[model samples]
Target: MRFLPSVQFIEQSRVADEFVAPAAVLANRLLDAKGLGGLPPCSVSYFIEELHRPGAAIGLHSKGRANVRLNLAWLAKLAQQETAPEWEVAFVILHEYAHFVLELLEAREVSPGATRRRIEAGHADFLRRMSHLGWLADPVSRKLLSNHNAIAEEWYCDAFAYWVAGTLPEPHAEFFYELLAGVRFPPTS
Candidate 1:
């Protein structure tokens, strides 16, 4: 995707100012690869570490911008596994991006009833649209849906992450499969 000049790239370390910390360059690269590299001014705010947790997590608000908390220990663990922790980081960004898309498309109608209606009414169309965009090729497994809220917006974000990863710089079938393997839904045609 082409990046416009309106985007601003904020380094995590700069936010902390007076401390030596783990670098978030990989995380930055992942967001860039996913086409959300630069945020528009207050559109996004990133913090290097968290006051409580020690892993990559995000605290979101009703509005667009969010505080992304990246934990060093969690990233180191993810790095030692295989692909960079960026995939998960990318997912974090897309999770918020999904919120943005939903708000834009739905005109701020994000209530539970409205969301479920949208998901159900647009179910086929949603999958088809995502599939046409090459998002549905990844099958959601039964293990995950078993424990997750089937009608939740979080599911949409998870599905979007899989789709973005496929089309972005890292096409990770294995990691995605692992993510989907936890799906609790039964397979369907």
Candidate 2:
């Protein structure tokens, strides 16, 4: 439950006024959040640049256990005009931390079907849409199905986010549940 090197983006100028302190506090708290003790040591990489496009992923969990990066560029923008900007930053960070923990706990060979079922149950609304799509156009669905390795990880990560911030204000949970409902990565056909 130790933090790695600090996540400093020298180019940061926007969220400097608001986000960084809370981000650091939340990251340190998460390292020992009890439920997330099994999670890997995730170091945040704050960047001053924009993501590939508009509304891209604000934070990403990658390279298994080493890195979890968050973009300060967007955060700064939100900070300038938004009330309680740090709370939003904290929420998204916990989401990425969820991804980190899932990667730490993942078995190398979890079957795609079993993994999908587990995730679907956890995210019940997606389960219904997926099941409906599975039934209505079985052939097309079979044709369209692709391995869900990364997506399954994302689902578990989403649940972890839910668990991590279960005590946060209601908007975070509502937004998270909405995100969870349409959670498929490649988009269901």
Q: Candidate 2 residues 49-106, lDDT tens each?
A: 5444422334455665655455555554554453655556665666666654444334
- Cα deviation at 78, candidate 1, in Å, is 2.1
Q: Predicted candidate 2: what Cα RMSD to the true structure?
A: 12.0
Q: Which ten residues in a row have the lowest lDDT in candidate 2?
A: 1-10
Predictions: Cα RMSD each:
12.9, 12.0
lDDT of 1 by residue, 144-185 (tens): 133342554665555555454554222233433332332213
lDDT of each: 0.42, 0.47
**lDDT of model 2 at residue 165?**
47
Candidate 1 residue 24 Cα shift, in angstroms, is 8.8
**lDDT score of model 1?**
0.42
Worst lDDT run of 10 residues, candidate 1, spans 1-10
